[model samples]
Target: MFKFRKKKNKNKDSQALGGLDFLSIFMRTLKLLSDFIYVVIILVMMLGAGLGLGYLASQIDSVKVPSKETLVKQVSSVTLVSQMTYADGSLISDVDTDLLRTPVESSAISQNIKNAIISTEDENFESHDGVVPKAVFRALLTSVGGVGETSGGSTLTQQLLKQQILGDDPTFKRKAKEIIYALALERYMSKDEILTAYLNVSPFGRNNKGQNIAGVEEAAQGIFGVSAKDLTIPQAAFIAGLPQSPIVYSPYNSDGSLKDADDLSYGVSRQKDVLYNMYRSGYISKEEYENYKAYDITQDFLSSGVAETTSHDYLYYSVFDEAKDLMYDYLIKRDGVSDQDLKNDETKQAYQDLAEEALKTGGYTVKTTINSTVYNAMQTAAATYGSLLDDSTGEVQMGNVLMDNSTGAILGFVGGRDYNENQNNHAFNSYRSPGSSIKPILAYSVAIDQGLMGSASILSNYPTTFSSGEKIMHDTSEGTAMITLQEALNSSWNIPAYWTYQKLLSEGVDVESYMSKMGYLIDNYNIESLPLGGGIDVSVFQQTNAYQTLANGGVYNEGYMVDSIVDSDGTVIYQHEANPVRVYSAATASIMEELLRGVIKSGTTTSFKSVLTGLNSTLGNADWVGKTGTSNNYVDSWLVVSTPNVTLGSWAGHDDSSAMSTSSGTNNNKYIANLVNMIYQAAPEVIGTSDKFTLDSSVIKSDVLVSTGLKPATVSINGSNVSVSGTTTTSYWAKNGAGNTVYKFAIGGSDSDYQDAWQKILSGK
Candidate 1:
């Protein structure tokens, strides 16, 4: 009984210890649960606090501190580089303006501001506190439907905030930022200051420079060419509406009257809204608003700046092309932009955003070399001839190029009939047949280089034949003729040119090598038959440089259109210096110049005769050394002239390569010559007389004579027998049938009239 009791007590103690162990386990489990709950609560509080801190940090970061230095740099008055003007201060085709922001303070500008605010955004802006509650409510309701409209319901201050702080993209984050900025702006600035800032930042239109129109004043001056103070109510409204979409609403962008119903309706509607708002806000008297509301919308709102010049001449198109090309290149490199980026919409938008950022960051200014007045004159000349020169006719497309010989500055150029109709630059880009223009260089330079002929060398114009086994050259000019090298060049005689080519070939001057030296890649060479004076290919820019070499006394100065480029800070980024290199001897170029002058005075280029008579006579009788080239079948016509001060080359041809009417008279039928002369007449006086040089009389001697492969005997009318004359005047004597001594008589009178008579004489008229 004692043993059983002890065992039972041990068992009871063991059971009690087990119960205690179970309690300890339960207590440990409860403690773990409590610790886990505390951890969960701490984690939740920490996450919440972290999120709240991040949100607050973002809000603080969004509040930008306005930098006065940045603002000064970004918003200083931009002085447009004033274009070099004529003596009379008439703008050359070039324009210059200050780049910094200019304020609009004119009464007309106030009126436009009042009108635009009322018309586009709020009819109750005067009573709003930085926000239009109704419009905001409407926008919120619209957002709920998921079809957000493009039209903004933001007040002017909000709009300014969006533009300045939030950027152009309409996004929720941007809107929030704009609201914050608007509230901040309202606290720091007056309504007028906000409005002025808005006006200064708003884009009213685009100038050729790719800059947006800033203020009402700038918009008025840029779009209408008038000051803001002179703007009419209708004009103001029209300009105000442009900020909505400048390219789309531009009067110049479309083919319609400024008073087109759509345009007037839009302008009038906007203007009325503006007036109604102004009247309600007491900014304008009820009478003033009513009177403006009654103003006729049909009347044309003419602005007063530079009157648009009309250009019908081909030369204008050529120059415009050069300018456009330069402009395109400038834009491309100005900011390291690419063509593909311009083509892609998203990329383009990105570029615009970058540009806006750059505008804020600042660094770009473009300076052109064109003279505005000269450009205008060129445009007018082009416009005058637009109807007569149908671009479709390969015979009469016009090309004009004007450059300052001394500086290599291209003053004005026109490549085609119109830039709107055709964008290809005929002046600098199009390669046209240069015709007889290539003859002077060939006759003077190539012949001398080959040791075949000298400037004063003489050759018989008598007909002869050439054969490279299969090809033959036949002289088509009537009668056997003889002419000096200079005379041959001035008259553009095919026989002399052929003979010269033959002589060069005999002297081992390969046709390709010779042409290559003169800037041509001659792929085909028919020793027996080549288009001697028939055709040659070259670009206006190349041709201009060639003539420029002659003008600069045989120095080749590369042609350039941009004078200088500067950063927004007025630091020079690019500076073009004069680089002159000798391409030919002074003697060779002088001889060529005299010969070319003979062209204007007496050669086939007699079209310039009337225009250059006075100048030619007074300036040592120095005339343009010019050449008139008409393509075979009259497909293209070219007139290239080089003066001491400038080199002007013009071409008229159809883009399609169709034939032109040769019936207009040999030299008179060509339109390019007439166009060139018009440009010369209208040229600014800054391009003074061409450099003067004395011709080396020793280099002017007439020596050797050989028949061109086309004519047989040298023909001369000595009292009518048409006797053959020797190459040199000293080698042969002349006499009439009476056996009396006869003298060589000039076939035609002054150099101006000689060319026509020579042609008639050559044709046996």
Candidate 2:
């Protein structure tokens, strides 16, 4: 018993020692944790202190805010479209605000107008500071979620800051700047001063006279025919609702005419909302609101005069419209204004405001390739010629497109007559059938390029029906004979063209696919569509581009108008660079150019030379090439003219598609010829002096019998003259190494035999 008790005591003592050791380790670990916490606290304090010092340092060198007077002067400065000029430094036009702005003090504007704007734009204008925290939070939340529309609860002071101090950039950085600027503006200006500035700079859509109706004074004058102080409650409310969306609720059309009956009542709902807000805000009594709401103000609006400048000359307006579109595209493409981003109302409104400001306040210089001399001549010729086609029922319409063949720069454009009276821009919008003019690009040039046909390749002019059941009639009065491909295009013989198209199809050539590569906008594909410009509709811009490919030696150069865009600060923001894509061989282009020249010499456009000489005797021997086309029932007359330097396309027709009124033996082609003559007559001396066509050496010259479709003699040399006995013609062939240099294929013979011959020719066996 004594030994067992002694052992238990020793074990207990050992356990006690082990417990003490664990306690010591736990205490030490706790102390270490406490020290770590202290270190972390000290580090955090140092970081905070460093941030505070940096902020203080930044505050020490604060940017000086502009004084109220300086701010007002900066905002009120006029912005012109810096100046648009031609390549030759000739003035085209300058864009500026057509409205007359008369700045007024807050007291000068009617109290009703002030209350109406406050109710519509900023409900807490009188109560809130420059920045509304709740609205900013809401906007931030909406932007982050990418859902729901933000109710921008901006105060009037913030709006003023955005327009007068900050710019209309919808970036977050711009928003931050706006807040800072607004706070600074509030310190330097009173509430009345801010309101005055805001009221004087707001855009209220355009007046009936097509003039910008900016500022309260101009708005009152434009919408009510009254001064700002004399505006009625209803008129004030109506004008106040416009700043949110000027275009959607515009009282006038783009042409300065009253909105059509369907859209005349557009702003009624907004006007009612403004009135309700005004009454709720205690600016007007309920009885007054009811009376104003029920007021029939139609007569008041009717009494107002349209601003006198609402009208524009067609040529100037067309060019301006095109330039504006180009500017918008540039901003969208280069500036990253994605269409998805514009879905936000605020972003869209900011863009609209910026565009207006750029027009009225942002000084920018736009340079175009238009030549004033050529433009004037085209206009004059169109006016003189169009008068003859006009009947007592309606007027005739015309469109012209002039491009530099080598450069693809649009030198001149005419959309339509009387832009103010007719706002349709035919030059860009009209998509009429090119008629037979498409024969050169769609049929002849393509046929020649495939090595299936040369300029001297013969196509029977006998009457026939196509495989697609499209019937073609050959005019025997002009003499029924086999026509060369050059003659087929020059004279525009339908039967020969149809045969050429059939042969192309039999050879398994996708004619439409080939033409598309050549930059022809073909909308439909059919066998019959190959001969004439049928089953497709194309614009003058596109037609000129296709022909320019031929002029540019088969390299397609995209047609462009704006050469460069310079901001008011003299920075070049946009410049055009040529991107030429080879669509056809140089040899093929050379041969086609020769054939087109034959057109001017003795084909459908032969009368052009006579017209040119008649217009200007100095141009008597002027070397030019072109083609003429007349649509079914003479609905459209087209002419395309090309010199080595310039290519011009003109069209005359009625917009309604009614048959042209013939002056009892009037040749419709003469209109095209006359217009082209006028354009060439006005060409600069340098153009005539520099214009020269160089033939490609790759084109082999051979004398071939048209009837047999074979070289009569093997020429020992490439350029040596070869003799042909009968029915022989000199042909310039694009050296494509198409074997079996003869096609015994004959039209009006057995179809199986011709097909067999074509199959052999295609295989090059």
**Residue-level lDDT tens digits of model 2 in 387-467:** 654654367777778888888988887777756666776777788878788877777777777877666776766545666
- What are the TM-scores, per candidate, against the unseen true structure? 0.47, 0.69
- Highest lDDT, which number? 2
Q: Could you tell me which residue pairs clash in candidate 2?
A: 79-361, 209-306, 209-307, 209-310, 210-310
Poorest 10 consecutive residues of model 1 by lDDT?
1-10
Error of 2 at 133 (Å): 3.6
* Residue 96 displacement in candidate 1 (angstroms): 15
Residue-level lDDT of model 1, residues 652-754, one tens digit each, is 7677777766532243323444454455466535445554555644343432222221122444443355443333332111111011112222211223333
Q: What TM-score does candidate 2 reach?
A: 0.69
